[model samples]
Target: MVRPLYPINAPTYLRLRDQIRADIEGGCWRLGQHLTLNELSAHYSVSNVPVREALLQLQGDGMVDMRMNRGAVVLDVNERFIDEYFDIREALQSMLMTRACQRRGGGVLMQAKVLLGRVDEAMREGKVRQLLEADHALQDAIGHMGDNEPAMAMLASRSRLLEAFRRARLDLLTADLMQLPVQGLAMLLAIEHGDPGSGCEAVRRHVAAMRAYMKKLLKIPEGRSRADASLVNVPTFTRARESTAAMPEASSTEPASPAVASPGPPTVLPLSLPPGRRLDPEGDGSNDNRSTDDGLHPPKR
Candidate 1:
């Protein structure tokens, strides 16, 4: 009965899907674990129908497998999958590079700065779940500067999953997640200089670094195999069916702007994002000193 930090006006199934995903990415839902509809429904206090709907949605994201014996189970993701995700992400981000450069000379980059600051704030204060949400918001703002709706849409779909991948990587990583803001800043700088090629290259390096780290963590071998091992005994990934419910995209458009911060050496981060404790819906999240969740809110339609 806790409210989501970034609440979406959605059905029980969709909200349940988010919780299941949060559990999975937060390492609560283990690999090869079966997620039965009856079990999930019982846990979330919802009907089986909605639980089924949520699992179906997860299936499309490559996070769930509907096996004959196992029913709906969490899939174990390997390096190739991570590589492909980053590859596509690189291409999409590249598509936005020129536009981002053209759009972000003055106030716009400051928006990204504030979000980055929130990342530091969230991390410093031990609000790791909020940090993940902030990461997505920051990237979305960078994407917005580029003006490519289709690419942005794809990024939005994978945002939560990307955050999961990132957290899992950090758990195995010694360095900080500063690669994000560092490369993000590099891309923005390239854009400001009106050099799309440089911006695209920065994106390439950004993805490559993450991919390298994932490979190291997974203990995947150095060289590419002659044939992709994944295809040989490919588990039948269900045809990527369209999801029934989607998180509303988070976005920002404001009249005032703050100064953009320069990226520096990364500070160490905690290994994992904590399980999300629901905010008291009846009560305002808190009367703490930090500003409201405006920077973290999911974009309104």
Candidate 2:
């Protein structure tokens, strides 16, 4: 299924909830910041109920919190929580990689190789969104290769959390982020040859590099260092699991948001992202073209 620009058939609350999630992931909302239902509803042009519902959903995801009188506030990252989060990610994704290697096909391998080239193109032009999308496509292809619906779904879900964490660390490691393609391209080559063992080793090294980069960015030792160092001194999130359960069923019809203006300078976006998903930093879609797989892909932003 294609990822919706907004929540599918969701009430205003759900729509607002999803937008908030997107905004948080987009860094539109800073950690430790409090958001009122009225404020969000106004911003998203929805009613208070949907906004409240959305905040509640975020709360459940440990991204927001509710106080006795305060509506909701963005959560601050804590050392313990961040470490636990990625620890879970490493465990799940490692399993996914192993499974994909066992039965991966030539088609999937070929697609991955093409995607890595897209990654190279995006990196050359410094297109952050393209890079992000290309990375997701590569990983999602691997997830599909696993041939297990549950594994694919789990990887998609967990990847979002990891994406948020990685995005937070991007600015701190300018050099490493720019150099990602070197290591990433090499990893894809290993995967393309059907060397599961090589793929595993390549991915493991990549993850280690990521961990090391984060540690260096935060000026802490690897493994022992907590990822929360990036968000320490930020505000804490209040739990909102109860709110997600409260969501009503999806609606049959709802209007999508108006298309956002294109980023200038000729950047070509996959038709799936279309217009309105975001503006290119460069504005020109074609200026920073990259190969993108067709279909409704998983969320990276």
Candidate 3:
């Protein structure tokens, strides 16, 4: 009698949804890969009923695309998607922070402090997953303080996907790992002191930082570029100093600390071709032979 990994009493579809979402976020399914009902059912040892239902739920989460004949295909994670994601996030987070500051309560403030402490601990230990979870929890606490159900609901809908993206690209964020929590703390302190303006600004600045980091990670151009189309072959992360060595230095208002400061320039992850993949310099995939269904072939258990 072996115990099940998920709770036995939970609905089958819900369990399947969690498993599938985990696989999708874990890079088990690549961009544009079709997910067939029969294959998923067989892979998870579940019936088609649960698999279909779970995929429908995931579709609503914006994690998959359900076509007329294609069934479910992994959604494309592209520049447009990232831009829209951060835009929505910045608006929602600013609203939540403003309202939270307006409705500040001692209990919620104390809870936020506790959550921030957890974030700091996770950061110090270099536990990326724990740090992300704790940071999200802290944000949730702040949002709850506002008691804006609709706003919070919108934020929750896409939170997991955003977290998954950040988690997957941790290598590009070594500098951000330290800077972000400090921003979170600043936002929390502004809320604690009932400073809505400062709080909202803090939230916006934090989101801006994230937006910049993500754009750099994805190699998304600020404007149109010839190199945009060839981004399908994602580059590996490199150190900020190495990436920004050729750029001129810029002045900073914030005092520098040994832990956060880079020796060369501001941290940035520049594009470099990954090994074993040929990319055309003209932003075309003509030279690349990589499969679009990169993760469709699951390993045998």
Candidate 4:
């Protein structure tokens, strides 16, 4: 049997590497932020060796540039960089869609449906983490749809670049604007209906929407947008509420009303009377006023 690849839980070196990469992606290590081995060691509670190993990983990912004497500084998202990243993303998405079309009508379609439900839930409840993970799941599923190992690896490598863009601008965009999940659903419908053209068009539309949104964010024209200056008109907190109110209802397929259980029958308990007190468990007091058959004078002690 073929050995499975090591997971994210490997030895210290791999774990540290994953952590540092996550930090950079999360913007904790901002652009031009110099992260030294000593600082990383102190922050991560690991020795310099693992930190060094993690830094090497970042260097390989092109997120860190090592200076002569200054150690590693994170790369800034420049205009050229954004343009190149989007160009590459457009190509990868197209290729992945074509591959998916070839391997249609199976588990891939079912997985897409499941992911679409998750996305709808996230949108209805405004769960950001769920939406984000759903996005990754859709991408991973698509990458697997390629079926061939070589094709899958190629697409996976390209998808990482798009992920970096997503992470960089997560704050700028709202959950509603990140509609990849919906696009995935549409693509699934197109594929399951045996329409390769529709599938391709669906994927193309998804890619185009992302490109247009990113461009709008940068405030530059479609093709020449600059990353540094790109920002959408962010509504104030009050206006945000107004916009949500103006929005339409959620999906028709959301969960139905939940059923609640009614209270059960009241509990019964045994009782004991205190000294000199007549038994009146039911509060009738029938025996209190009347004398018993053999009573002397109600037990004078």
Poorest 10 consecutive residues by lDDT, candidate 1:
225-234
Against the reference, the lDDT scores of all candidates come to 0.57, 0.53, 0.62, 0.54
Q: Quick one: best TM-score, which candidate?
A: 3
Residue 101 C-alpha lDDT in model 1: 72
Q: What is the lDDT of candidate 2?
A: 0.53
lDDT-sorted candidate list, best first: 3, 1, 4, 2
Q: Judge candidate 3 against the unseen true structure and give its global Cα lDDT, from 0 to 1.
A: 0.62
RMSD of 4: 24.3
Each candidate: RMSD to true structure? 18.8, 16.2, 17.0, 24.3
For residues 1-301, could you state the per-residue lDDT of candidate 3 as single tens digits? 1113776699899889878888766667655579999889889999988988898999898888887655698776666887898799888888888778787744677667667767765554444456666777877788888788888777776655654554445333354554455566667767767888877776776676666666665654222111111111223323333433433333466532312212552221111223554323221234423333211111255
Q: What's the lDDT of the predicted structure labeled candidate 1? A: 0.57
Question: Residue 218 in candidate 3 has what lDDT?
Answer: 66
Checking candidate 4 for backbone clashes, the offending pairs are: 217-231, 218-230
| Candidate 3 C-alpha RMSD relative to the actual structure | 17.0
